[model samples]
Target: MYDINTKRLIKTFTDMAKISSPSWGENAMRGYIVNAVKKLGVTARQFRSGESYNLLLTVRGDTKRKPVLFSAHMDTVTPCDNVKPVVSQTKITSDGTTILGSDDKAAIAMFLEGLRYNKEIRMPHGPIEILISCAEEVGLRGIKEFDTSVLKARHAFVFDSDGPVGKIVLQAPYHSTMSIAVTGRAAHAGMEPEKGINAINVLSEIITLLPASRIDHETTVNVGTISGGRATNIVAEKAVCVLEARSIDYRKLRKQEVLIRSIAKETSARFKARCAISRTLEYSGFTIHPDAVISQIAATAMARIGIRHQFEVSGGGSDTNILNAAGISAVNLSAGMQRVHTTKEYVMIRDLIKGTKLVLSIIDIMR
Candidate 1:
């Protein structure tokens, strides 16, 4: 069993929390992490990207088993710049002004601390690869830019989800974006109202006809926002709504899209409006068997760390979805961050320490 440095981990965690790293603005954070890893005498490299660079670090191990990969994103959500973290006696959080960004910075610190501890103690572990991705807060573009061929291991663990340390997410739903355009006649609202057709009315009718909220056992639809209006006096000539549909089952997702299209067409025909509906598959879903080797390894690792565990399914998607699609059986690990993507985001210090312990245990499990 390897012992992690509590004080060093806390100091690193606090230092990382202070950095303002939002999506597409991860350059500073990446540079800092790269330098930190280099100072530790590890091989660190940066992957070229449009906005932010992906930091990749490798730690060689004995020839006992295949390499194991650990992944976490480097970017936070909006309002992340100029963060002012407020730490109480038990936990660390941000002021009311911005988010705490525990969504991934906590994971990054834990990974780095784990590497430091492993190197210091000379833990007998397999080859380890640490991938710090960027722009994950914005539609997983960072993972999308990753080169799958560079991966030497088929088993990976992604530290990104919120909750207790033992929560393991093995499945996530596939997502798609739906854009509906409603066209109608433009006329004065007060005068010639009869001659004018309201696109808003068409939009409302379509929304009312579609199956929203919970679509089925594993499907959902949400009309996020709508726009397109000029003046109160004139009828709206055009309106558009950005909607999203998600499902764990591909066939079911396509069925849901068909239903949305049907509603659009029916409402448009009824209101004498021209409707154009377009949908793009944002990302595919992934399901890993609980009995697979990857799950077994993670379960063993968590158990070794004295943490109870269970497999879970997530409705949201992440880079794990992309990695699984790329043939690596990736599972999302919980890191104890709460209220993510909000100003109230926080992570218990105890849980963060336990998360670091879990990472070290995982290394031993893979050994």
Candidate 2:
């Protein structure tokens, strides 16, 4: 059993939450983390990734043991500027005006505390790598640009899931994004309404025909944004819509994608309008068996900490997906973030402490 510095852990997390790290703008948060880690006598290697940087820190240990990787992101969703974290006896929350930014910061704090504890007690461990990614909230832009060839570890653990500390995400969905642009003849609504194609109407029809919102147990789709019409008095000549589809099974994802494209093509032809469609694979899905060594190590870590382990399949993608696609076997572990991506997001103090202990335990198990 290991003792966690609960007060220090909470302070670190709260301080980090106050930093503004919106996607594609994580320089300040990256600097804060680098300084904190340096206090523990750890040096961070910076890799330029898009608008920000991805940080890597390696702790030397027994050469005979295989190295393991731990990862989290430094970016948060929007409305993160000037965040204020309110701490109570039970949990930490924002002032209801802005998000608490616990989506990934809590994991960073846990990593820092684990390193601090290890140094204080001289805990014996194997080679451990810590990766802090940038722009993860913006479609995983940072990790996508990062070169995985530089990593020495074959197995990685991502601390970015939203659940209790004991939950382990073994499966994540393949994510794909779609952009649709409908083009039609523009005409004055009052003068010649019939002469205009009203692209907005055609786009609406296409959306209605497309499958949406919880397609199945393993699949989901959503149309996130729509924009059209220059003025209220004019028939819209062009309209655009952006949506995404995700599924744990690649076949299901592909089927949904095909169905969407077919609907757009057929619908536009019927309306005598031109439709332009663009689709991109955001990231591939990943699955790690429960019997895999990484999963077993996580289970053992949780069990040793008196927590019941739970395996879960997540609908969202994280750095874990990119890592697995890059040929590294990785699993995402819950960092106790609840109601993430919202102003009401919060994390429990107990969960934070337990999560830190779990990190330490996993490191010990890998020794």
**TM-score, each model?**
0.95, 0.94
Error of 1 at 217 (Å): 3.3
What ranges in model 1 sit over 4 Å off? Answer: none
Q: Residues 17-86, candidate 1, lDDT per residue (tens digit)?
A: 7888988888888888987887666788788666778888888777677889999999999788778888
Clashing pairs in 2: none
Off by over 4 Å in 2: 188-194
lDDT of each: 0.87, 0.93
lDDT of 1: 0.87
